[model samples]
Target: MADLSDATLDELREALAAELPAQAAFDGWKPAAVDAAADALGVDRDVARLAFPGGAVDMIDAWFAQVDREMEARLPAEQLSNLKIRDRITRLLETRLDILAPDREALRRALAILAMPQNAPRAVKLGWRSADLMWRMAGDTATDFNHYTKRVTLSLVYSSTIMAFLDDESDDFADTRAFLARRIDNVMQFEKVKAKWRGAGGERPSLTRFIGRLRYPAI
Candidate 1:
């Protein structure tokens, strides 16, 4: 095989340096043997072709474990050093493009609907006040007005959160289960309220059309 160019050799050397030394454990993925088999053999493997000691299965395992580490290291050190940059930019943008008064007013109206006394007729009409409160806490009322326009949005959100919790079967399985239980409780209560509201008033609010038009309102 032709000799690797000086630059290529240097890149391989750096990879070797990274592989040989016990690099810091980043994002819970640690290289098993610091002295890389690839570095020693002078044939470093890129992330795409993560050829590990074992076979294909081993490569898959190693690739998944190293993904987080690789992502963190892929960017230059200077870019990584500016950790607060994103937050600063977001804050600046928020300041520049302030929430329009109309939107705030809309949210305020929704919040008022939620804030009504538990015994208010409008509150009762909406359904169990607890459900509305839960929806508000879910953040559906603020930006999207999803509660008004998407009755099933809260259900979808609950299901999504449950799925996420299930996916995160981390060391603390109990924690995930507990989170799921709380979310399920909220959804159950919300559903009960919905059923009761329909019984009290046979009415189907136009959430579908509202969401559809809201996506691209015809001015």
Candidate 2:
């Protein structure tokens, strides 16, 4: 909580984003939640409202962005470099779940807002952004079809895991952890099969290689 006397709206948004969720858990992402967060952060309520012009979605978006920032802060590149790719991805996702666990009620309400037909596109964008960040943080450098596929697959996995987590009552969320592990295992198996097929020179054409060739014709 720094001095907001000279802070811009975006800075105020970021400063208050982490605090809003706890209030949202009680106020359900309304003006009162913003007011509560503003009071807690010593930010003026009027200025805080200016920071989130898009209303609930804006608040949810800022909070989700804060989660991304926290995720990177918790797991820096050097810390992940020595691990296997699967382990890195698993750790990154698990870390996010842990960061979000305390604000599950707020997250549920946010998801409800994002699920509306009017908000579907924004929801998709947010999901992709998070998935992309996770992949980058896990050290993925693929620029081919793998890039798109990995993010799409991970978005699905992460969303499903969140759904499972919302209702999971097992000890330490073991059920959700098991569900995530199974999804990751399935993805790893798929990658292994794809690699084996490529190595064995199967007749199937490579879409990524074809796209690459289209981009840079034989020189």
Could you say which candidate leads in lDDT?
2
TM-score, model 2 to reference: 0.89
**Tens digits of per-residue lDDT for model 1, 1-219:** 323334353344444333332221221112333224354444534531333333322322332223323433343345434544333222221221122111233222333433446525543333332234333323334444335422343333333333344345465445444454444444444446556766788555455543343333232
Top TM-score hit: 2
Q: Report the backbone clash tally of model 1.
A: 0
Those runs of model 2 whose alpha carbons end farther than 4 Å from true positions after fitting are: 200-219
Off by over 4 Å in 1: 1-172, 202-219
| Candidate 2, position 170, lDDT | 90
lDDT tens readout by residue for model 2, 88-115: 9899889999999999999999999999
TM-scores of all predicted structures: 0.22, 0.89
Per-prediction count of colliding residue pairs? 0, 0
